[model samples]
Target: MAVFFDAIGQGGSDGHPFYDSQRTEHKHVANGGDIAVLAGISYSVTDLALGPWIIWDSTLGDLTRKVSYGGVDMQPIGVIQWGGTAPGAVDAWTEVFALAGVPAGEAQVVAAVWGGMNSQRALRCQTVSYTGVHSIGTPIIASGVGNSAVTATATATAAGRIVGVFGTRSGMSGYNGSQRFLSNDGVGLLMGDAPGTGSPQGQTVTRQNDGPWAGLVVPLQAADTVATCEPLIVEPTISSRVHRAPRTGGLRRKVFKVPADFQ
Candidate 1:
């Protein structure tokens, strides 16, 4: 009869020999897709104040997408709530709201929006009240500083959020303007800043690689680099160091050398 037994090659001679192996660990940001919230109402801002939409990214992985700027049209992926149309106006302001299921992290709240909209502007602001414990570098905190590095009238230290704060008007005066803004606390971290107590604001965005919108938010801008329409993020990945690796194969498949005639 032919023998077909597998060999359990040994490396040590103390009556027992073994090999060690392990699995690798990896980290990635949760993808924030199809999240819901309200954005804008059907009324008008009597004082012509800025509006902000607050939303969160699903994953905390590296932010990958196009570099969008202000005044550009953006489609939100969340539910929105507007107060309907104004009493006598055909097109009026709308109230927006959203909830980014992602918990607070070390990264700031990076966001982008359509610039030069007829009657919309994005601004970063502080959260006036929240159950979240945000680090000073979080987006909400970063949105409180003015471009001049001075404190704006609406700060976001204890419980505040940011708002879109840049834009100009050549015709409609109170309508056409910039629709996004970025802010950083004194410590240095860009964050998303929305408006009011519960407005719908977006944190960051990514796009499909093979689509037309690809150029808008792809190649993931490094968090340390400048801000574009794409969501700015620092992705996480698996890392390792060799303690003692087998040179011939992977961890799951290994072999051992035996002394001649030792068995």
Candidate 2:
């Protein structure tokens, strides 16, 4: 019962139409636990019927949760078209969104773009840590197009249940604005057992997309205890730095000179 991967925050929004929206703030100095915030987005448009929206700011303690995905007729898994005329003629689009649990400390992940075109957006936040007695389920929007492999099953009524499968990549149009990290275009995450129920009951997790706009995190255990399907890379303890010095004495020193034609 140990899962940890903390630190990685990013935010962006240019070509402003009043600065659409963007936020990625992840700061956890240990002590607290149970947190998962994974988000992604990339955009640039001129209207191919324009579309791409995501908003997530899962606040904990006092409660202020929110979740939203793409719109304006969604159907994207990497689409492309640049400066109009005749290349692909779409404009630009990229979306890979995810938000889980988020109840640790300092975790603000948001992304938005509703109206007023002229867009250019980006947001990424990945911070995970869970140890002993965990529960976070409710977000399983699966569809990897051709379905090379995508599965997510759940059944852990009680008894040390640890299942974590996170994923992104929902309706992505293209223009290649440098193709932001979708796991480098061949997404993969595995934790087996759910094909014929031959193990100690049942618990499965698998994802292998080879396009772009992707996201994944699979970790399961408990429910008769027959676990595998584990690929939730964790690495991030804490390291913050900031130091500057040049003042030590408590005395005073004053000097007044002349001005010889701007010497």
What lDDT does each candidate get?
A: 0.20, 0.31
Candidate 1 residue lDDT tens string, 210-262 = 10100000001011123658877876665544343467655453545543331
Candidate 1 scores a C-alpha RMSD against the true structure in Å of 28.6
RMSD of 2: 24.6
Instruction: Please give the distance, in angstroms, between residue 87's alpha carbon in candidate 1 and its true position after superposition.
Output: 2.5
Q: For every model shown, what is its TM-score relative to the native structure?
A: 0.18, 0.25
Task: Give the count of colliding residue pairs in each prediction.
Answer: 85, 9
Clashing residue pairs for model 2: 76-171, 76-172, 77-172, 79-173, 79-174, 80-174, 168-215, 191-229, 192-229
Query: Largest TM-score belongs to which candidate?
Result: 2
Model 2 lDDT-worst window of ten? 186-195
The number of the candidate with the highest lDDT is 2
